[model samples]
Target chain A: MYRYLLHRILQIAITMFLLIAMVFILFRVMPGDPASMVLDPKMPPEAKALMKKQLGLDEPIYSQFIIYMKNLLHGDLGRSFYYGRPVYDVIMERLPNTILLFTSATIISWGLGYALGKRIAWRRGTRFEHALTFMGLLFYSVFLPWFGLIMIWIFSYRLGLFPLGGMITPELWTAGGAGIIALVLDVLHHLALPLFVLTLLSFAGAMLLMRSSMLETLREDYILTARAKGLSEKVVRDKHAARNALLPMVTALALSLSFSMSGGVLTETVFSWPGLGKEIVSATLNYDYPLAQAAFIFLAAIVLMANLVADIIYAYLDPRIRY
Target chain B: MSFFEIQGLRMHYATSRGRVKAIRGVDLKMDKGQALGLAGESGCGKTSLGLSILRLLPNNAHITRGRILFHGEDLLRKSEEEMRRIRWKYISMVFQSAMNALNPVYRVGDQIVEAILAHEDITKDEAKERVSELFSLVGLDPGRAGQYPHEYSGGMRQRAVIAMALACHPELLIADEPTTALDVIHQKQIIEKMDELREKLGMTMIYITHDIAIISETCDVMAVMYGGKIVESSKVRDLLRRPMHPYTQGLIRSIPPLHDSVGRLTSIEGEPPSLLSPPRGCSFNPRCAYSRDICRTSEPPLRQLNGGLVACHFAEEIPWP
Candidate 1:
């Protein structure tokens, strides 16, 4: 087990290294010059040169790579040009909010999707199952920003029930001595809209995959053996069919993270929720190279970690999937 | 009353083409402690017949008509909840592919223990003890019980599935091609082990297989299925010694004689008739060498011939030609 874990960890490390290298190359190859984007066109050529030299943009690409590697080793992610502060600090501040939003969104979507998918696979020909599949496809294929806006228009703007946008009531931040419960409740209330939108975006993928996977699993020979053992439908479905069905979905989780994280970007932006997704967006729009790079690295690390977790789960769920 | 009896059992599979009759008007009976072997070629409905006894047919395959009387009570009439209590407790089944029959993620012994716990009011510890006993009964080392199905070899896995079937000491054990996927040596061992278990436990069993040779070794009574019907049924030794039905004779001849003959092996001439739209009268008429005008025009009713039953118009004739 330890050897297997070591093998996986080594694999993850190599993946992360390659990812970092790839992103660095991508940022370099993009057409925009960071120094020019950061400065005004009216600036004199020598002043622009001085600014470029100061930012180390004039350094040889190899030397820049070395400096990037050195700073990375020291846990430095460079500085955000627009924020004029450490990229690490800026991301760290909003990291928890994105984690809070996307993590819950993902878990809820997949969990509900998995349950519904199980039923859909079992009652494959039923009208209700067909309706759910249509809904899942509809929700999954709908434009995210458009969907989020529509939800806001219905639930907040017109109904006047929810906060229209942002993380929390701006007035509440300065309200001193508000108990942690109220504070938490206030954050959740603010979180409600984005979470729902993100969750809605997240559902369709998991549901379709799980349904097809479970449908295949139901026909597996072991399932027949399970029934022959005289187990009830519930036990046969849960312990026999769903247990095996859950395996492919578990392996697919790593791959799905990229799409869902991208969804998180749109969901966060629409809600005006200050998270890494939103940070990554504005940073990219402003050509804040350091911030964008850091965000890329962070998201890349998350994907690698998810992949690693998926491997562990595969090992746990399937005895055949040996290290 | 017979220990178990199946009367007029018919299972029809609903396909896009049409309703394909898989098992039609099949009747069987087994006394307590008797081992009945169901033998046929592939797609001959032998497995379907065994599955029908437990009402485990697939969703598309419906049991159109049947009375599976277990100890004088009709099993088909039982509710799913009641069937749950009776299944694995009163009857259990072993499958064709032992590798696929056992869940890979679980320890072989734990699966047995779960089967026991599902049907019996026993603690985990008690169930584990029974598992150990079952392992030894099936000639497996008790220590190997902790290992997952993948860790065990194919033979060991078959033994594990058998151990699981015998866990609750069900009155009836239906082994559906339990040795088909094993090597020749394992096949013999599995057949012998099943026979020994039947004798030692005094449990009734329905041994379903395509191998006619293995039947006499493991079963007391043997029934031969053709297309969607049972064409012959009798004591295993008697049936093997003198198979009456033309289809049964073809099946016996299809296998090489053990005493060494220098002739090419004889196999039935045609494929199994499609159950969707079978022949006008007899399904096997196209395949039978002795099929006559009457045989093609009228379905032969199963009738007593000597001490056995044969469903052929010319069962009394000496020479098949």
Candidate 2:
């Protein structure tokens, strides 16, 4: 197991380095000049040239790559072009909101999807199973942006059960007009629609996958063995069959959490929720190479970590898996 | 009332082709401490009959007509809820494929403990004790029970399965070809272990196997089933010395003699008849060397012969084993 861990950590380190190099090279080769974008249009040619050199844009691609790596190793992610703040700081500010918003939605959907999926598989031939299967697939395949828009139109605009858009009331927030409790409540109120939209978007895939996995598990010989053990139907389902059937669901949770570092990008943008996804969008439009690459590097770490966590989870879920 | 009995049991499977009659009008009865050996080649309904007693047949299969009476209670008339209570607590099965019978994720001891906890109002500590006892009884070290199924060898896995079957100390244990997957040494060890347990616990056992050698070692009474029907049944000693049915005679002859390694030892001539659209008369008629015109036209009933039961038109004519 120690050997396996060492191998996996080595793989992760190599992968992260390659990713940083690739992102650095790709951003450099892109058509837009970061210096021109960051500086004023009225600046003198020599001043412009000085700004380019200051930003290290005047260096060759290979030299720039080495500088980026050296700076990255020392915990410097450079500065954002548009904001003139450290790229790390800009992302750090939005990280909590993104995590808070999407994590809750993802977890709730995953849990319910897993539980409901097992039931759907067990009662496969029944009408309730079929109805749930159809609805889950339909919701799962619904385009995320379109679904978010519809949720806003109906729940926020038509029904008035939720706030229309934005993370919080910015005016009140900026002035510190509301108490801490009131601010928290206002944030939750704003969170409801986007949370609902994000939950609805990811729910179906988990459910459908669990349902199919459970159906296969039901046919396993251990299920019959459990039945022969005189286990009640409920115990047999939950303890014997569903426990084993849940392997894929666990994998889904780990992978989704890891790979979706930029989760609900369009949803965050549509709801104007001030998440990293929305921040990345603005950073992209403004040609903030440092911010974009910082976000990309963060996502790379998440994906690599998620892959490791997935392996560990697989070992936990199935005793057959060792390292 | 008999300890356990199955009367007029017909188990049929619905395939894409049609309904296949796996067990057609079979009858078997066992006393409280009696062990019945159900010997047959593959597809002779031995496994089907074993599963029918527990009402654990697959989704596509059902008992067409049957009465499984345990202690005079008609199991066929029992609701599914009642059957669930009867299972494991009263009668448990050691399935054919022991290697896959255990849940791969759980420790072997946990699976056994779970079975004990299911029917008994016992604490986890008590359950763990029972699991260890079962493991020890099956010749496995109790500490090894913490290991997963894959960690155990195939034979050890089969032993663990046997331990799990005996967890609740069921009155009746149905072992469907339990030793078929093991090596000869392991087979002997398992049989010896089970025999010791049966003597200690007095549980009724139904031993299913194709190998006649296994039957003599494990079972007291023997029933030879072919084409989903028991053609002959008697004390194992009696049947071995004098097999009245021609099919039984052929079966006994097929076992390779310990000393004589001569030209290919005799084997039952043809393959087992397909359950789907089975032959009209005796399903074994196509393969039976002694099959007569009457044997080809009519299904002979199991009738009493000299101190034993035989289902053959000319049991008296087939002189000796």
Each prediction's TM-score against the native? 0.95, 0.95
- Model 2, residue B66: distance off in Å is 1.4
Q: List, residue by residue over B219-244, the lDDT tens digit for candidate 1.
A: 88999998889999999988888888
Candidate 1 docks at the CAPRI level of medium
> In candidate 2, residue A78 scores what lDDT?
93
Interface RMSD of 2: 0.8
| Interface RMSD, in order shown | 1.3, 0.8
Q: Show model 1 residue runs off by greater than 4 Å.
A: A1-14, A40-49, A255-263, B260-264, B318-321
Query: How many pairs in model 2 have backbone atoms within 3 A of each other, for residues 3 or more apart or on separate chains, i.e. clashes?
Result: 0
Tens-digit lDDT string for candidate 2 (B1-321): 898888888889999999899998898888899989999888999998988889898878978887999999998898989898889999999999877999998999998888888789999999999888888888899999889899999889999999999989899999988887888899888888888899899999999988888788778899999888898999998898899988898898889766666656787787888888888788788988788899879988999987889899888887772
User: Can you tell me which runs of candidate 2 are displaced by over 4 Å?
Assistant: A175-177, B259-264, B318-321
